[model samples]
Target: MSIVVIGSLNMDMVVRTKRAPEAGETLFGQEFALSPGGKGANQAVAAARLGAEVTMIGRVGKDSFGSGLLEVMKQEQVHTGYISQSESQSTGVASIVLDEEGENRIIVVPGANVEMKPADIEALESVIRQAGIVVMQLETDLNMVEAAAAIASRHGIPVILNPAPAQPLGDELLHQVTYLTPNETEAGILAGIPVESVDDAERAARILLQKGVQHIIVTLGSKGALIVNASGSLHVPGFPVQAVDTVAAGDSFNGALAWQLTRGKTLDEAVRFANAVGALAVGKAGAIPSLPRLQEVKQFLQEAAEAEPGAQ
Candidate 1:
């Protein structure tokens, strides 16, 4: 089964600061790094590295950053047939400040991402309809994401919604989602309930399910992820590692979860697999470059299982 990611592509410019800047204050950073990012691109890379036949749908600008981002996608074996170039706007960019605790604050300039229109979705509807899973993020226009979800629903193809950079979502969009995975903050924003802990996550998940979401997965940073469905909820503990960067951990989780679900794994099984993949992702440093290969995931899972017979 193939996976299609419909979203944005961006070049991330990051700085390592002691902490997030306060209002009216300027902080000096120790270093700077440029990386390949964008919720859509990161998820595509995560899925591709996990052995999925993946295709990306997004827009970039006629600039070096856009060119380099496409090249990175190609290197990850992600099909770029749906990618387009924008002459008027520059490619999307994210300016991020990462602290010593591996936490980050970001500012995004939508750029070409703001130009993604319904026509673009219609143009790629055929490829999207043939997919086993269609993953989307809020980095692009909300109407575009809604349009894609509508089409995916019509085809009976599952749509995985990762509401990153979370914003207000309409009931119609939530109802169309087969699976909704949001981090604690995003879940809090959507559910209108606190999701600061595992128990809080479970509460928020129930609220989302009541809102017509079929399934819910809340990423809890180092505490791992909470998986909730009609059956019940499960907390998947994260692996302990010294994280150099946590930028793409959530994207990796969403991608791996899609991969497992497409392979017919149950939600519980899929989340367990995804948790391992996400943990491994954070132990490394960039976004796309940090995604783990299929063999590596296998090795990590095997070793973990050997250590504990009853492990997930």
Candidate 2:
């Protein structure tokens, strides 16, 4: 029951400023930090920390960032067999700015992430086939995402798509997806509806399901996530936590959901765990450094349980 993530791996430069900059404006930053991040890497780390056998498939440049990024994956116990280094392109990068309110504005340079070709997926066919869940984001080449989905479909592996930085994809692509998890903005774009509330989320999710996605999970940040299926919908509200940075909160949710599914938990149960994990993530700073381990999650659940009024 391994989880495979096929997406981008990037070096992130995060800055904290008074507020997010406008289209052509610059502001003085209070602090700056370099971190290992990328939608792919963040999800992989999130899953690995939650006790899943995780494998990461992506590319990095043949530079220092590449070396360090590989080490980071190893440290997290994520299988790096499918990660490669390319000298032709530098590592992908994300320039992120967090305002005083913890809102972020980001710009991504695809770099080596864009260089990942379908052939890369083709070469990892064996690994892809062994996955119980294949998770993906839109940071890498969409062709590669499609190739992985195609292979996963052949093996009966469930494919989970998190269409972040939302882009247009096909019903063909949607048909191959076993689970489609998107934030409100992404759901709005994919379902062509104004997704401003839970009612809108249900409407949007139903539209995607009609397009052939087996399940739809629309993440609503502080509002938690809405899970929709043929049976109906359920809303799992977020845990109360003081948010310091919200960079990888969605990735953490996706990763935790995949881990729970691989462990044979129902989608409803998975969303509960994912909600807790995501709430914990935003309570800290930096993507990699903020991920909670399995033990930490266990402890959190225990504490929450003890705090409940209905006791022995």
TM-score of 2: 0.97
TM-score of 1: 0.96
lDDT of 1 by residue, 1-312 (tens): 999999989899989988888899998899999999999999999999988999999999999999999999999899998899998999999998999888777889989997988877977789988999999999998999999999999899999999988898998989999999999989999999876678888898899988888889998877778888888888888766678789899999999999999999988789889989988988887788889999999999898778886776
What TM-score goes with each of the models?
A: 0.96, 0.97
Error of 1 at 9 (Å): 0.6
- Candidate 1, superposed: residue stretches over 4 Å from native: 309-312
Query: What does candidate 2's lDDT look like per residue over 187-254, in tens digits?
Result: 99999989888999999999999999999999988888899989899998777777899999999999
Off by over 4 Å in 2: 309-312
